[model samples]
Target: MEHRQLVHFLAVLDSGSLTAAAQRVGLTQQALSKSLSRLENELGGKLFERGTRGMTATRLGESISEYARDIIASAGKLRHTASAALGLERGRLVVGLSPISAASLLGKRLTQFAQNYPNVRIDVEGGIDRDFVAALHRGELDIALSSQVGGQYDGILLEQVFSEPWGVGGCVNNQALQDAQSISDLADGKWIIGRNTDLLDDIIAETFSNAGLPMPKPGIMTTSVLFSLHALSQSDFLAILPQSLCRDFNGILWRDLSDGAWISPIYMMRRRRAHMDELVSVLLRELKG
Candidate 1:
């Protein structure tokens, strides 16, 4: 019911343990339990089911967590706004980066931002576009840099930043595929594909279908870029990777496809609000600059 109770509840939910949550929120375990108990009584339902290992949220807890986050974030934004008006800085920032951004220089910028704003707490998370957008809606992320994805983002806005081209990459030392210049040329080649790339899958399928070629089955499926790169080194498999990543990695070489260069448009995604937070504005300036 109180702001402190909600904060404690979130801490426990996030840490999944009473002792850890208490430590995180600077409260004793017994005190934290009392807060939770009072909250559950006010709400008339058990928020979490405790077990020997850790606590797990019940159905009510799962649904209400996002609302709690938004409420807490809104309250913090008010404080941050007041601080900014006095030429001071405060509050937390959670940023979500796409796979390509994670592989590029964005991470270094994050470090710099954290160092410059010592009063702020920043958390960086890595995931694909949809996942990042979902985090934004849940108030888990303040800003997200990710590839463009198609969906009904009712309360989200996407601002295009840049585009990264994709290429079919193979081992640099593979002489057999040296003369291959397009997707058709690698018709019979094995592929190492990343799984759970929903939009990228559509692009790949459409590109091959336009070339009058059926979509090739992946020889190896994974959700890791490192695994794909290592597989290319060990086998005759090809993969579609960000040109920036391919250009720098030794033992990897890429060629332009005759059909089209799959363009991954990177966007700055966030939940729509009446006014942007000061930390968000500062971080955007740093990234844009």
Candidate 2:
């Protein structure tokens, strides 16, 4: 019923234990229990099932989770709105960046944002696509630059900013590049890639299958772009990368796939109905520029 109860509920849901959630929320176990009890009573439904492992949301709890998150986001936006009205000069924004996008121009972009909004506080975290989208849904991120998202993010809106063909890259001296004119030519080569969600992995597999080649297994899998690039440059792993990198970096060779089947798209995403904080707006504008 109370805002604090929802905060406690979310903390517990995220932490997975009353004890840990209590520690995070600066409350004793007893106090947190009282809050949860009151909330459950007010709603007339059992919210969570407790066990030695941790708390698991009940059916009702799961159904109401999204509404709880929206309420919290709206409350935070109201605070930011009031603060902005007093003097549009102070606010906080957390921005999530995809690894490649983060490494590209994060320093210059953040520097410009800070100069433009000296009173604003900015927190930046780099992550994979799913992690960034999860953070946005949890209300932990105000905006994110990530790969194109899907319906999994029910309340987020996306705008595509950068799109480039994805190509297979490897060390310039790799023997595979010497004979490779198509995906079939590289079938025997080792590949390296970033973390693959089932969706991305399936796409990669289908591309090879459509070419009548067996799916190439990645010899090295990593979440770090630098590591993936290093694997390509130092080893024989053919990696998927933005085609632009081949023009920028030396000692790497990129060749377009025979089918031209892959393109990497970077998107700017935010909560669909939330009010844009001034600081977030400033950074978004700079990114668009």
Candidate 3:
């Protein structure tokens, strides 16, 4: 029930052992045990089952984690709200992104945000959409940018950033492409696909299938955006990229699919709020601006 106990609970869950969690929380082994015991007594159940290797969350502990994180996040938000009322102008925001999407939100905008709100702390982590969405539900991330999303997330909302279709692209100076007038001409070329999920593979399959061609076996499956972009520009892989990038992204040139355009949208994601927080609003504005 106590905030510290919940914090300790999560520490143990994340760290996977009492000794490690105790060390992390700056508590002696005995003190951490007592804290855990007090929390178990309050909740009327054993939260974790201690084992020789480490501690494992009992069913109760596993289930209570989301509620614990929500309570902690709410409490932190309340503190921030009070601070804002006192004109403190201090805040923390966490953002999640896939590497390529950073181009949309980082650079000048990120630098400007840091300069204008030096008191605000920002944490940006790179990951795929599903991981980011789970983090959002756990109160880990403030916002995210993603290319593809599906299924239901309980408290998150998505906003499309663009509706433009991505184009197939190859090295601007690839010798093989000089005689090519359509995607079919490069059907045998090695392609780049996403690594974190099968979504990109499926998209490739569908795009080729729609064009009445067998899918090109992926040459490189990667999550590193820079590598993918570099490979595309440097004559190593054909890729579907942002429309702007397809035309010219450091030597990548757009090539027609010759069947139809392949649309890959970019979206911004955040938690749904009845009343938006001031700092979050500012952050969103900077990202979209």
- Score each candidate by Cα lDDT: 0.76, 0.74, 0.69
Candidate 1 residue lDDT tens string, 186-254:
888888877524676788788898778998788888878888887787678888887767777778887
Model 1 residue-pair collision total:
0
Task: Output the lDDT of residue 143, model 3.
Answer: 81
lDDT computed for candidate 2? 0.74
Whichever of 1 and 2 has more TM-score, that candidate is 1
Top of the candidates by lDDT? 1
lDDT of 2 by residue, 201-222 (tens): 5766788887799877768777
Ranking of all predicted structures according to TM-score, beginning with the best and ending with the worst:
1, 3, 2
For lDDT, candidate 1 versus 3, the one ahead is: 1
List clashing residue pairs in candidate 1.
Answer: none
Q: What's each prediction's TM-score? A: 0.71, 0.67, 0.68
RMSD of each predicted structure: 5.7, 5.5, 5.8
| Deviation in Å, model 2, residue 1 alpha carbon | 12
Q: Model 1 Cα displacement at 258 (Å)?
A: 4.4
Which scores higher on TM-score, 2 or 3?
3
